[model samples]
Target: MAQLRYQSRRFWGGLVGVALVLGGSGCQPQQTSTETSPSPTASPQPGQTDPEPPVANPELAVYWVAYKDQEQLVLEPTKLPLDNLENATSEEQLVVAFKRLLEGPANTDKTNAIPEKTQLNSLKLQEDGIRIDLSREFTTGGGTKSMQARLGQVVYTASSLNPKEAIWISIDGEPLEVLSGDGLIVSQPMTRKEFDDNFSL
Candidate 1:
């Protein structure tokens, strides 16, 4: 009986030991740890800067001329600085004004009477007035009405700068003694009042 009891105890103890070992093995972790790094970014190279913006021009005001309702000569004042005329001498300023006049009316509602081919030959500023010489084209082709309007354009544009003074008009350096268009005798040193008497609203 004692021998049989001993064999039964041994068999139960062996079975319990095997079960513990199997349980411990099954509970063991598979991984230890994990780590990763981020990718690098590129930097801007030398002379790879952004572009700059445009510079603006300075400006000033001056006078010009345009025709109104197709009959009367109108004063069209505008900024003449952009043409580098703002700092020019008085003579140069007159030249600039005439240039703008020859360019024609900027506004769609106005029109120009001065001939396009007419060139400013010389400008002589005097104590009491200004003397102007124009190309032969100044007197070519325009009839009475056209010639009158063209003369009005010059008189108004030039006189506006010095309202108290007069302006003498000439063709190719010769005195405009007569207006061939209407046979009107032109006096030296023509004033705005004289032009206004002939044509104005």
Candidate 2:
């Protein structure tokens, strides 16, 4: 009997020791993972929009001839659209203004003094004044009045940026001294004020 009791106590103590070992291990803190998944990027809403485009400002003007009456004609200025000059330089703007002037007026009552076939050869902006070179057609087919009117047109249009500055006119590659068979003499490096003071259209 004594032997049986000893064996029973040993069994119970062994069982309790095993149970304590398991319970102690379970009581320790658990190891957690440190890595985490990245969150998804947010998408734009359906009604959302981007920025708007830039708006153009009208600043340039081109000169055209307008008939006041059967007996009278005048020089008139028309504003050119700025949308055509997207990111253009000062020289480029001047070139475009000249081209627009050469294209003639849109109104039926208004007219362009520049000849239809005349072409722009080159234009140079200098420190003292501006230089404009045109095709030989510029000097062709015009009476005294026509020559005066065309000269006024060119002077006004070239000086649109600075009326005080002088302009040197050239035909083909040479300087224009005599205009046409009508014998209209043109002084080189002319200014708008000078043209206004000396000639009439």
Best model number under TM-score: 2
Clashing pairs in 2: none
Pairing residues by index, what is the TM-score of model 1?
Answer: 0.59
Please provide, for model 1 over 1-201, each residue's C-alpha lDDT reduced to its tens digit, 9 standing for 90 to 100.
899999999999899998889778976777756654533443435866545568553233333455668766566667555456546787777777777677776787656656778888887888868988998888877667667767777776676666646888889978998876568677778887876676543
What TM value does model 2 have? Answer: 0.68
Candidate 2 local lDDT, 96-179, one digit each (tens): 999888888889878887899999998888887989999998988868888889898888888777777799999989999989
Model 2's lDDT to the true fold? 0.84
List the candidate 2 regions with Cα displacement exceeding 4 Å: 1-59
lDDT of 1: 0.71
